[model samples]
Each structure stands twice: as C-alpha cells, then as structure tokens.
Target: MTAPTTPAAEALPHQGPAAGTTPLIIRVHGTPAGQGRVSFFGKGRAVHSNHKKLMPWRAAITDAARRELAYAFPADAARLVDGQPVPILLGAIAAEITVTVPKPKSAPKRLTSWPITRTSHDIDHHARAVLDALTHAQVWKDDAQVVEMTIRKVYPGEGIDALDRPGALIRIWPIPTEAVGR
Candidate 1:
C-alpha cells in the first residue's frame, strides 16, 4: 500500500495566524529523538538506513503538530496553502528543547535530579531532526528561521511526569526586532 497525503488546503478553511499574536507554540510530545547516521557508498553516494525506519515515527509527530496548528489557526494554514511567500522571520529568534528520558534503575539513590546526558548522539543532531520534522509539518517556512537555540537532554527530575516515561518539550519564539543588536 502507499502512504497517505496531507489533505489539500482548499478542502480546509483558510485560517492562518493573526498579524500580531502570541508566537506559535508546538509540543511534539515523547522523548526527543535524533537523526540517523549517513553511510557512504562507492562513488560518493550515501544512504541512511535509520531514516527509513524512522520516517513513519517522524511523520506521525509532524502530522500531529500540523493538526494542532491547523486547529488553532486555520487561516494561517490556508495562507501557507495559498502560496504566500513565507515572510521568513527577521531579527533574532530562540528555540528551547528539553529531551526527557526515563531514569534507569541502575542509578544511585543519592541522585535526586535529572543528570545531564553525555552521549555520542549530538544534541544538534536531535535538534536538526526535530527542525526538519517541524519544517515538514509547516511549523515555519524553514529551519533556518531559527537564529538562537538552547537544547538539553536529560532524565526527568523526581515528581516530573517524564520520570516514568520519556518525551521531548520544544519551544520556539521570535525575539523582538528591536531587541536584535545587529
């Protein structure tokens, strides 16, 4: 069978975001994930095996985020569908991502908080994956729109819901143009 497609905007109402409003916020739910490695082949070709496996998983998250955005701002979604050039946000922008992983049983009792994670998986790699997914989800015109970003990967602290599970919390916002120095 073939994969399904995003419904056409014509079928949906034209409801985008307001001219001046709270910046869009999307929570991708679940442990923040990363991208797969690229394996090189002869003649400079490359392939990503993990990507094929992760496609569906990533698409699910993207689709869910898009749905939420559509529900929240139909006009905005339709504006994008109308082929309006994405007025790439100018000035500085910031993004914050918190990757919460379940604590392991092997942990010592002395630890009372989520410890910083040091892994081979680069934090930017995970952020790239998320940005790519969000771009596909139409969270924005492009990932380059983000100028400043802060990311963290750690086990959820005690009393935190993620302590029992794993998930990602992402925040994207635009900085006032006046706030920019350059």
Candidate 2:
C-alpha cells in the first residue's frame, strides 16, 4: 500500500501509437512542442505553416502525424482482403494517437529557436521527446540545421525556462574568438 500525495500524473505517449493496424500519432503542446515541430522538419516557415523544406509540411502536427501513422500502420488485410467483418468487440477501427498538452511550469517571455527534426519514428514522436527534454533539460545536441530542431538546446529542471530563449542558436554559431585584439 502506498500513500498518494498528488496524482501519479499520466504517462505521455512514450511508445508508438496504440496497439493496432491503425497508426497512432501524438501531438504535444507547449514550448518544446512548437519548436520541435519546426526543427525536426528542418524547414523555416510562417508561424503556423510548413514550407516544403520542412518535415511536417505545415498542415498541423495532428494531420501530418496521422499521415505518418497511416504509413506506419496500414489497415488489417485479413479482415478487409479476406472478406471478414472486423469484430464488433474491437469497435470501429481507426488509428488512434493521443496528443498530450501538459500545463507549463513556467513560460518564457521570448522564444528563439527549435530543433528542425527528431529523426526517429515521425514528427509527432520527436515533438513529445523534444518537449519533454526541454522540460527536463536532459538532452540537447547542437546540430548543424538545414531546417528546424536541427540545433537543440535542452534545459534540465525549472519549468517555463530557457528552452526557447532567443538567439540561443546564434551563440552556437562558429564565431572566431581572439581576433584583432592583441
């Protein structure tokens, strides 16, 4: 038996979408969530649009993720091809992926950049991991970005902090020091 203080807190989509032929896609909201989208895709764009160079393609992460899921999880052939009805117990079959929008611990006044891409499963998975990383400051890699999330700076603890700090990438640029001084 264990005493409960605060809620256990629901686990975000840690694994692939749900277990089924239908694909699962998850969209996370918050600082890292937004930036992760841009970075992972490796494209710069309008505040809410994805240019061709990017991975997500500007249709909203949910829609983009759904398409990704469709490829990852094609319809069951045994039922559809073999001419058998999907069992009633399973309910209408469609890919089911959940996006988790956790409340922020703190928020930044200004945001600078987000990684262009995660490069794992799809755009959605990377977003969740990137945002989570930004929140926890566990993982950050200064990558040469042709798009978004290409250059990542993950902060550890302290919510609503500098995951989106301005010019964070500019600092990472290869600037030569000790010039014209002595």
Candidate 3:
C-alpha cells in the first residue's frame, strides 16, 4: 500500500517571554505507529531488527522535520556537512507531541468524552518513534538534547483540527541556556 500524504510542516511564531523565537511544528498524517521492541537474531555476532511499521513512521517524521527546517531557516539550508544537512537546533530543547488516532467505528456513540484506553500501543512507544525520527532528520544534534518533553495520544476530535485524522503533531522549541539549572 502507498504511504499516506502528510501536510507540510509549519514554523509558528511563539508569543511568550521569548518573543522572537518560532517553534518548529510538524504534522504527520496517518495512523501513528509505536516503536516496537527490537528483536535479536543471529548466533555469532547477534543482529537486531526493528518493528516493520516503525521505519515508515520514522521516515514520515524525518521528512516533515527536514522540510520545515529548510523553510524556517533558508540560510541554514545551504550549510551541509559530509553531504548531510546540518541540524538546525542546538543546546537544550523542549518538545510537545500529540499523537492522534482514529476513532473506532465500533465504539458506542455515547462514549464520546472518554480517553482512549484501549490503544494498540503505549504513549511512550509513540514518543520514542517520533524522537528517533527527529534525531535522524537532524532537527537537533541529538535526542539527548531534549531536556523537556510533553507527549500524549488522543483520538481525532480530542486534539486540534489539523489532526482530525490519524497522525501526530510535533512542536519543538530551543530552551534558553539560562533555563537549564533553575
């Protein structure tokens, strides 16, 4: 089957104590997949494999991130090292991610306001997949730079209108150096 089409990523102006900075926002379209357990194989050296669905999800996240980064910082788009695009954000980073899944058709019509408790995967697993992809996309130097993160999973209408279908919304900010210790 063909991969689902995702909307273009956006860089939204942040309005707060930090006025000039804009947060990188990415909307990934399609059913969000969790990072599956790594399976080990081979007798001598030991090999490992990831979940079948994880690669596609990660690719989607990476592509979206790259597109947004280039659009947000056009000057940086030309800066490449070893034929790879350099990461845009550095130092401590903050991320907020919302994964939205489709509302099941079998659900009772009366159960509209309740949280999704019967998801196929845990919230953290979904976070892992996205984070890893962001790292691969060179959105930041490394996932370790993410000092603050808020991630959640919800169904369609429970989240924003952009995510009315199954997908994820990722927002990333670079935390000021002064905010590290305190």
Candidate 4:
C-alpha cells in the first residue's frame, strides 16, 4: 500500500540533516500506567503468563508516537527492505521521558514540589511501557536501538514544572552513526 501525502510532507525537504538533529517530541495526555508484573496461571502442566494490564496505556503511547512521527516525517519517506517498511529514524536513539502523575489526595497542599516516594509503581516500569509502545509504533527498528534513556517520574505541579496534568512527555533524538561505539 502507498503512503498518504500531505501539504506538510510536500513542504519539507526530502533529505537533510534536520531529521537527525531535530528530536521527535510526543505529549501523551492521560494518567501514565506502569508495566505490570508477569502473572502466571493454571497448574504445573499448563502454566501461562497474563500481562495485559498495561495494554491501554501502551496503546495510548503508540497512538501518540504514530501521530508525532507522521507530523515529523513524510508519509512517503518510509523505505522498503525485505518487503517490510522501515522506520524513518534508523540507528541508535537517545530518549528522555518525563512522566507526570496526579498528586495524591493524601499529599499536603504545601508539599507541591516533593517527590513521590511512597508509590508502588517505580519509574523504570513506566519507562518500559513507553519504550515498548514506541517499538510497537515503529518509531525505530526496535526498543534495543535505544542506547541512551533518561526517565523521570513526578507529580503534577512539581518543582516549577508547568505540566500540571497527568501524562508523559517523550523526546527522542537520533544518534549520529559516527557517535556510536565510542
């Protein structure tokens, strides 16, 4: 199937260093969900894991990534290799993800800038969900392509931050080929 064309795509240069330098930013507006633990079911002879709790969150992230990618890259820019479509950003990637969760009702009003130390979900679990969603969206070849990642979890209105809503802000930069293995 052919890719869709748009005015924005037509206006952008077909080839340039901009793609490499400019980071793709995606703002997912919703309560961020952490990756759940693997839960096994059935008896010893037939045990299987059920890890579906984060599916909704993952789907949201995938949708947001897809929209951001479409806005950043031309639809026709996709290349074919071995009969499969290749993602625009190839090679290693550096990602910075900021997850903002809602302030707990139990938190004191004066404690607006404090960290969330009592939460059950860890920051790494949230990062995993986002990374997996990006992979599903084909933002890159695989999640393994992410060589550098910085993830932070915070409550809304924390530490001079303007994002008062519960969500995640993801920024992905393509690492230049020459910068790898150094």
- Tell me the TM-score of each prediction against the true structure: 0.65, 0.18, 0.79, 0.74
Candidate 3 residues lying further than 4 Å off, grouped into runs, are 1-17, 43-50, 113-118, 160-162
Q: If both were scored by lDDT, which would come out higher, candidate 1 or candidate 4?
A: 4
Q: Who is ahead in TM-score, 2 or 4?
A: 4
Segments of candidate 1 deviating more than 4 angstroms = 1-21, 40-46, 80-92, 113-120, 158-164
Q: Which stretches of candidate 4 lie over 4 Å from their true place?
A: 1-20, 41-53, 76-85, 115-120, 160-162, 180-182
* Residues 1-182, model 3: lDDT tens digits: 97654432232332222446677899888767888666556565532144566777788888888888888888996699999878888887888898886676776655554335645477888888999999998898889998778887777766443377778899988877544332
Residue-wise C-alpha lDDT for candidate 2, range 59-156, written one tens digit per residue: 34434333433454346312332463222112212222222222233534265323333321244543444333222221112112211222233332
lDDT tens digits, residue span 35-75, model 1: 76888898989865566645654675687667767777676
Q: Which residue pairs in model 3 clash with each other? A: none
Report the number of the highest-lDDT candidate.
3
TM-score, predicted candidate 3 vs. hidden true structure = 0.79
Q: What is residue 175's positional error in candidate 3, in angstroms?
A: 0.2
What are the Cα lDDT values of the candidates?
A: 0.60, 0.28, 0.75, 0.73
Which candidate number would show the highest TM-score if scored against the true structure? 3
1-182: candidate 4 lDDT, tens digit per residue: 97897766555422222343877889887767788566455564431122444677788899998888777886633556887757767887888888887777777877655545646267888888899899888888899988778778877767533267878888888777644322
